[model samples]
Target: MGVFLAIPVSTESFGQKSFTIDFEEGNSFTVDFETSFSEGGECCGPYTIVERFNIDNYSYELIEPSFLPIFSTVYISNPD
Candidate 1:
């Protein structure tokens, strides 16, 4: 439905890592380690569409990272 990613790092490993998510529907955005997804993974949806629209493609530049996801935790944490 959407996309989310988090990279855990210690102060020692912290650096200026970056990434970009390009949507087929368009609102492409870039994120970095300092700003991280602490901003957001903007979702493009009508949600009740006849079918579905999703992340077109994504790429990231990490300096030895951890994990990723198909929707942010905020989407999970706030069900309203």
Candidate 2:
């Protein structure tokens, strides 16, 4: 069985934003987020773990924004 987690992001900083989902199990995912001008453009992701693994408490930060996944096939398009 896989575990799912919810990761929250602050959309107030940017009108339309996305986030890279990382796991301690050597896996990762990405989700594209959008919102109307009235809605404020905030989004959250429901992350799931495919394989069972003991994930220790970890921390992460959003270093930069890119159209590519850095080193992966995951791509998100943000249309303002």
Tens-digit per-residue lDDT, 1-80, candidate 2: 33444555453443444556675665565554443223222473422211111122332232223321122232333333
Q: How many backbone clashes does candidate 1 have?
A: 0
Over 4 Å off, model 1? 4-14, 34-80
Residue pairs that clash (backbone atoms under 3 angstroms), model 2: none
Across 1-80, the per-residue lDDT of candidate 1 in tens digits comes to 65555644343333354556555655565544331232224674221111111222334333323333212322222234
TM-score of each: 0.28, 0.33
> Over the full model, what C-alpha lDDT does candidate 2 score relative to the true structure?
0.36
Per-prediction backbone clash count:
0, 0
For model 2, give the 10-residue run with minimal summed lDDT.
47-56
